[model samples]
Target: MTPDDQPFRPISVFTDIAIEARDIVRGDAHQEIPGVRVEEHQARGVRVTEVEIFEESAERLMGKPRGHYITLDVPTFKERDPELRQRLTGMLTDQLKTVIPQDPQKSILVVGLGNWNATPDALGPRVVDRILVTRHLNQIVPEDLRDRMRAVAAVAPGVLGTTGIETLDMIRGIVDQTRPDVVVAIDALAARNLDRLLGSVQIADTGIHPGSGVGNRRQGLTETSLGVPVIAIGVCTVVQSISIAQEAVQLLVEELAEDVTLYKILREMTPAEQRGLVEEVLGSRFQDLMVTPKEIDVLIDDMADVLAEALNRALQPQLDRQEWT
Candidate 1:
């Protein structure tokens, strides 16, 4: 088919790594706009996908920013296998260490962004409760022990609905007061694919948009905005209803193309056209619905444990190793 035969497409609204990775996996060599680089790897059965949008142009195209985005896919994290859990934790700590500043003495602030009352949004708050907070302990600990341990502090700023305060504003105020060298923000994210929900963790140095996962985007917390390096860690806890319906229609079109005349007609249409048609039919019904797993409460607890363990180890590796050994 000629280039002109392609249908006009709407930009994707999903804020997950897999959507961007799809273009590369489909063998679309030119799909990557200039200034973007992607790399993939495997660590102990987990798939690690990394996408770097290096310039404003590429950032605009990806709808992210000029920083590194890393996604770790471990579909069986909820299974709670000891060995697998340990491996995943190790992988998470390794990735986090890469983005975090290397200064051993630098103070680090951990910001958990979410509403605790909602299970799907409680991942962050739960994680904060599990982190190894040493900032307060540093003052009373012996000099040698205190010197060896990094200063770490954590906070879970409740959502605007409860506090009537913008989450970013709270963080900014804390950042100004604490003067932390780096800020690590954790929150629940929304994925475009159901397979990604509850099975993936994303770490980025580009900062985070509170509530972006469920499409209620708020002001972003970033290095430029906060005057400190921000490292964001998130787990996909929900998927949009439109994405589910769109994928179902695509599957149906593929399955029936060989025999059904109508399916054959759809098969001849450009991908954009197919998606457009699907949206026209399903958009109104599915637009605002966000779907999560039936076992989200259990899954959120499991994820919070995993993420908290990883962050604890990453932020206090020296102390963590000493304790474990």
Candidate 2:
């Protein structure tokens, strides 16, 4: 049996976070999915969920790779409260360390994978702007002065549209030359729920596919392609327009239920049927559209700063050890 009760919506399902996909899969598929493990905990007031898929069957069932996915859900992240900000950053730092190889000497190449020109898709570039780059610091700064920082490099490779070069190709070239032991990629992701946008971060060992969130497919940056371990950090920056419409329609139906005929019809339809009806009404033009929040301009910067701080803490082994102790 498939993870989901209904026939999976292929394109739409890909846009959801791995945890959301797991939630949908948990209904009636089985009491549990073999080779898949899920654990949840609270850290610094944030909900952290870790999903581990140990076998090919589990990987195929989840539509994610055979590795680990850690998600941090803190919807208030968009509000820009400084105290809350530090807490979430600390949580993200701890989760990031789990996926990264436990080697103090591992040099890291942080690849920011998104279009810098578009604010909604610019999480990668924005984080790179604030991240502490220390790969070149060894020659000039003394070890003690820099707190024994690891060699860390960062790059924001523009999308194929602007640079006319495949993102993977550019990163592969960098990896070949820099020879970093691991690559951490950051990108904007799309979620089915509006609340998750600008509020959730999903980190995975499966790397990432540029433009996949918006239904535009590109070659994925995975371990096999990059010849190194890859840890992808994704922040939900947009939500599918169709999902917004779906919620609106549901609310309208529920509010107008005194009229019964339409309410009964909707109640009789399956989720797939409801989504299909919404799609038909929305037509093909709006199918691929994704949306961001009204205050994205300010929130994006705040999010970038938080992610940069977390990356800094996670990438530096000396700092990571100090804090964990």
Candidate 3:
């Protein structure tokens, strides 16, 4: 197909460190990423009202030392392709160099928090694939030894599938054995917008929940759970089926609004015809939304690299100072 006739590519917009509830709507309304639209009001007329839980819990959970949160908003999924992910990962490493404490002895627990079997919930495994694992690196001698000074481990506690084992149980087991100074949990998260897929990466000091992907709620990995700092890195990957339909409808409306002929045709068509058209446009393909799994693998791989770099930066200084004591 010619360039114009080709399918619309996914767009992304990356914002700086500042995150307010307001940016949520602004990002959508401004089309911060081209080609996609975010409708502010919902169909039932109930608007989204965000409650700031952080302000309330700051006093309760604020005392613990943990990694800082950084958000990178890419304008399009295509822009964050595999190659871009790799470059970004390196940039993230540089950025981390600037942020993390330079502690040579500091041991960190890099927790990959998702099941390996599921594609949508595979962020943990994908990230762990790119990290510098200490155990493996320790096997080599001095000259050939990789970066083995920093402590790192990958864990994916199967949700419910582990039978009666709780997430905390697994974390506690690891902490008891490894005694890492900090823990970083990477997992997939749910986003209200379908456009967020493979584009937005959120870094938070707060811990994460493992299988919240398909709506299975569980306790989170928190300082209280493990008596250690926890960092969460995630990208929102899934969109509700209804939300996909609504987005398709919104795109259709925008197209009809600009083209008078199309508008007239849509207006004249029966409800049944409109339903058929929408169904045809949105089928099983939409179900496997977000970028292709291959694309997601690229995104996750890059995301992991960026986070690893950031962690290295954050930890290296502290490590150098021999502060793990």
Candidate 4:
């Protein structure tokens, strides 16, 4: 059958899925989960949830040693709210700073987890790109202004490259060379749903898997494997195609482009126009297979900046408290 002979395609929309606190695994006394009163929901196809299990919420939590493990559900570039994103960043930063160890001479190893070439899985690389990497600062800035930061290095392990090094091996080598205080890993994650494209960022004290984005799970990067404490931060960037279809429908409900607004405009459209504009734009091509417009690049940049800031803030206190005590 010819293209025009095909019937009008039906659009699919995705919505939030919900979860309760009782269903999630709880951390041990020493391995506690922070920000409890846990709840779960879905956005797009990404799982959205919140928890508050910190042992010391208002007291030494900020001053004492601790770790942060978090995950965020951000569904779309077009849908992200700047204010909400910043607020989440700030909360994660505050919690992480409270738990990180303080020591000026101590070092930190950061791993950017995920494949860089894929846009949906590039959150890890994008975050590391914006970091104030301490190791490189000495070459660019005067020694006096370098602050108390002892050392910092960022790495992204290629999944199939000839490098042939495992995530654990790379981190172990860094730990052996630097003997740093801690390690922080940033990675992209799969949510049960698809809505969390850019609206959330999660931070956790536990370890991480390097190539979880593409479903290649090797040995995980955690404290036990490297003999060093590990903290993980992640954002859910991909979701189900059904959710994408839903978002497109919502967009049409509120606004219409001048060219496509008129049923008359649509009436006059040729087969080529229908296929190029309405059918494609409102179909899976816009939602699933492609990255849509160029503005999404900006959204990724913003997410990277927010994550980097949160990581830096979490580490700043350790930089400050290093020599004092």
The better-scoring model by TM-score among 1 and 2 is: 1
Give the alpha carbon lDDT tens digit for every residue of 1-325 in model 3.
Answer: 7954432222111121223222432332433322112233221211212112233222122221233455455535446565555554544444445333346456677777766676767767766765656644555636422343665666666655644687778888889888887787877766545556665566656566565544465777888888887767776665556345645665676667557776667766643355456657775455334333346666655555655555544554334323222
Q: How many residue pairs clash in each candidate?
A: 0, 0, 29, 41
Each model's RMSD to truth, in Å? 2.9, 3.4, 12.2, 13.2
Model 1 stretches with alpha carbons more than 4 Å out: 1-12, 16-30, 321-325
Q: What is the TM-score of each candidate against the true structure?
A: 0.91, 0.89, 0.61, 0.58
Looking at candidate 3, the ten consecutive residues that score lowest on lDDT are 42-51
The TM-score-based order of candidates, best leading, equals 1, 2, 3, 4
Higher-scoring candidate on TM-score, 2 or 4:
2
Alpha-carbon error at 276 in model 1, in Å?
Answer: 0.8
Best by lDDT: 2
Model 4: lDDT of residue 244: 49
What's model 2's overall lDDT? 0.81
Worst 10 residues of 2 by lDDT: 3-12
**Model 3's lDDT to the true fold?**
0.54
lDDT of every predicted structure (CA atoms): 0.81, 0.81, 0.54, 0.56
Question: What is the lDDT for 173 in model 3?
Answer: 89
lDDT of 1 by residue, 1-325 (tens): 6755432222466655634434523332445556768799997988898877777755655567688889999888767677887788889989988888656698999999999999998999999998888888878988877867888889999999999999989999999998999999999998877778888999988899988656688999999999999999999998888888777767878899999998899888765566678779988788788998888898888888888888877787667465522
Best by TM-score: 1
If both were scored by lDDT, which would come out higher, candidate 2 or candidate 4? 2
Alpha-carbon lDDT of model 1: 0.81
Q: Distance from true position, residue 231, model 3, in Å?
A: 0.9
